[model samples]
Target: MDRPELPLAQLHAFLVLAEELHFGHAAERLGIAQPPLSQQIRRLEDKVGHALFARTPGRVDLTPAGRELLPAARRALAELADGLAAARAAGSGRTGRLRLGFAASLAFTVLPGLLHAHRERFPDVRLEIREMTTAPQLAALRERRIDAGLLREPPPDEPELKFMTVLSERFVAVLPAGHPLARHRTVEVAALADAPFVMLPRASGPGLHDRIVELCREAGFVPQVAQHAVEWQTVCALVEAGLGVSLAPAGIRRIRLKGVAFRAIEPGARTRVAVAWRADDTSPLVAGLLATMSEAGPTAAPPAARPAPR
Candidate 1:
């Protein structure tokens, strides 16, 4: 028979009948009345010009043609299934280029583990990592400029985004070695009520900086801001210069500033870093990155006051 004239539906019906060895059950699986299924089978047999099954009172067995075609049919279906699984996985960013966004600090620390695990599981996936702040990352995600983000918590007010809090890290107060609070076992957040501070850019990580401010407020007064340094490294450098104290997560300890000291903040002051993407976007690449990040989990922790909430 010419390929163009072949009835795929009948072939499918024939394959189902072979598996079930029963007309009614195969019909049920196909969601059609049994009579129609039987007619379809008859048509298929007519096309093949042969009887495909032996009909007995309680049993149905494959005839020569049926026996011959069964394995071929199954092999074809198996090929289709394998092809589809690979296509689906590839379509979902699991196989192709993936644009991943993160902060400068995250790139050296957690991003390494995330990239390692992500690529190991999906070796074919090409990774593009961009270092950007939480705000720009959010904008790029919304504009379809980036596939997914790994950053400190997003602006809490972004109703258009859905985020998951993956992991939380404790706050580490960075101070000059001789600073008054550096000698304590665990520095109380309250002790910094009047302390001058270095902070991340208020526009870029307002949610995080605000949480730090709120923590200070809970301790009794608004934190005194002496300088606003954007990057974690910048904050560490400023602290080393004895400009002011800075509060960051434990991850910041990786920076080896000569005169800076790191002490864990008491009462567990934390900044929440999350993975964010457009809640309604339907890109498979986005889903793939999300799956990767979901499997990657969160980086870390915090809560409290804000001038303009993020």
Candidate 2:
């Protein structure tokens, strides 16, 4: 025969009455009248198909069937309570997973501090970080492959994504350590006008690439591209090999390439790093991260630009 479904209220009454061994006391403890408590226990006994208590005018005692059901009832209630608590914690974003995408160059700038602060505040939240360039990060955000992104120069036309600038840095020139201009405290943009340039492909990071080209135009000349690299480290490495000069965010100076020099540029150009997420996302995990970013402040100071290895 199939077992009857037991109601939680009756199980609660049975447990209480079993413990007190007095209907009047258990009813008082349960904040119900003695007659209702008796009804609850009787109803439970009917479902259980056995008398749960041996009653007398003076005292109450448990039957063997009641003894067996007692432990199982406690476990069921405890497990339900635990499950409810876990659901609440996940809904509040105190425990869950957040998949984030970031531009590789950000590691030298705001990435570490931001991640550290988030971990400290939401320790139970699992952070999954993916290193990608700006274009790929944007595509990932649109496709829901990532919950959030840390990227440079977020396009203003992306109405579907909300962006907040987390860092801004001025551009710096990268040159071969032995190049003549490497000896100067600062290199004028116009001075590199005739030099062959090593640059990140425009397709990978259009914003930064176009900004460099715009700065060159403002300096009354266009950069003569001699090579292209996909990452800042590679761009610096190519410059170290004497392939060409390049312009990069000041943070790129931290790469510490032995044969490359980083110098401040004249008529400074700047780039922004932003945190972005889909505007329509309502997940508390996303909200928790956005709140942490707001509390940390709108912008972080980039590492001070310094002359490197000349």
Candidate 3:
């Protein structure tokens, strides 16, 4: 047998008539004429295959079938309303998970502040944070593996991606606490021309590596890289171990490594950290995060805040 689908208009009319018990009053409540209301009730009874109301000359009352269906109809309407609300929330980015990729170096500096601010504004959003290097972060974004990336390297004319710089910091010299040059408040880049350098590998962050080399070359000599580490923190650790001195963003000085000292570099070398995502990504959750970043402005924490070593 074919099941009869309940029409909302007829169901609503039936419900109002059942509550009023008077055809004229129910018609008034429904903003329809009494004759039309009566006709709608009759059509509803035929579709339901049940006489749902007992009509008297002056009044009406629910039949057993109508009494039985009242609660079910109410529950169905409630569920429909709830479903619509959920759909709207999802569309507005009020709830969902955002996959975010960030450079490992930002873990101590920019990442925490950005996360905290975002969480405060959008508590229902789940931030799935990943620590990755520049190359992999860009690859993940291109593959749609991550919704957005916070990285030190800016894309080179990739038309499919859009980005903006979130923070810029002067490059400073990181050296062992006892290094002779550490005695000065600021070190000239030319002063370290012959010094051994502990650097992050090119594969880990090619843009940053190349930028440092370029800065050194501009200072009159190529840096002598004595060791390579996978992370900025590791590079700083090596400097603390007296392996060699290196150049790093000023914001990195916020990390409190006992044996390392950070000094301003003269004729400053600078680096910018940027956030990027696919130009075609139009998901509300991604848009929400982008809006939050835009509102939060540049997120460079003062170097005085000591972050735990990575």
What would the per-residue lDDT of candidate 1 be over residues 214-252, giving only the tens digit for each residue? 878787878788998778889899889988997787777
Candidate 2's C-alpha runs over 4 A off are: 1-3, 307-310
Sort by lDDT, top down from the best: 2, 3, 1
Total clashes for model 2:
0
Candidate 3: the clashing residue pairs are: none
* Model 3 misplaced regions, further than 4 Å: 15-40, 299-310
Q: Give the Cα lDDT of each candidate.
A: 0.78, 0.89, 0.85
Model 2 steric clash pairs: none
* Model 2 C-alpha lDDT per residue in residues 164-192, reported as the tens digit of each score: 87787888889899999988878899999
Model with the higher TM-score, candidate 1 or 3 = 3
Candidates in order, TM-scores: namely 0.67, 0.92, 0.88
Listed per model in order, the count of residue pairs whose N, CA or C atoms clash below 3 Å is: 12, 0, 0
